[model samples]
Target: MSTALKSIRSIAPLLDRVLVQRIKAETKTAGGIFLPESAVKELNEAKVLAVGPGGFNKDGQRMEPSVKPGDKVLVPQYGGSPIKVGEEEYSLFRDHELLAKINE
Candidate 1:
């Protein structure tokens, strides 16, 4: 983790809320061509930072979250609460708000 991210470790999500940072869009092509800022598309992928202890199920049993810190996941194009920590921005979402986990 980068030094900036180390500061984020102090924050812990509560009750099934997940904290994530979006993966940065590539600014350069594989062939070494630099792309304009407008040409970079925002990716829907994000890295999980912190996760809350699981939420309670209808039966009152605690259910564990499916994803853990360092896991890359697919997020929705919208929704999720935005958070700003220092100069960096992050997003907070419910466990279910995450679409899928990326293995690569």
Candidate 2:
């Protein structure tokens, strides 16, 4: 399938889960100085790009996730599994790992 189709398919069944693509941090300081990778810290905010089917409850019912694609979310700095899609880096985590929905 095409890349666009694949991305769409990945989100179709997302009942409560979400797929996020992290935003790259600024490489330059406010003073226009360049910062190295080691000097930078991981950011907790990200852009939602895909979602999964809702999670299962104790009774087998599906629990819906609150966020959706295109939403900016706050995630744990150290959580989530890293994934590489094509030439880009992405991360996949359960809905629980997302700490909050950032309002913008």
TM-score, cand. 2: 0.77
Could you tell me which residue pairs clash in candidate 2? 14-52, 14-53, 15-52, 15-53, 15-54, 16-54, 16-65, 19-50
The superposed Cα distance between candidate 2 and the true structure at residue 15, in angstroms, equals 6.8
Highest-scoring model, lDDT: 1
lDDT of 2 at 56: 86
lDDT (Cα, tens digit) per residue for candidate 2, span 1-104: 11433343343433455678788788899999999989877777899888887898999998888778799998887867666545666777788878999897
Best by TM-score: 1
User: How many clashes does each candidate structure show, in the order listed?
Assistant: 0, 8
Task: Give TM per candidate.
Answer: 0.89, 0.77
User: Can you write out model 1's per-residue Cα lDDT over 1-104, one digit (the tens) per residue?
Assistant: 12345477788999889999999998999998999999998899999999999889999998899999999999999988887767788888999889999998
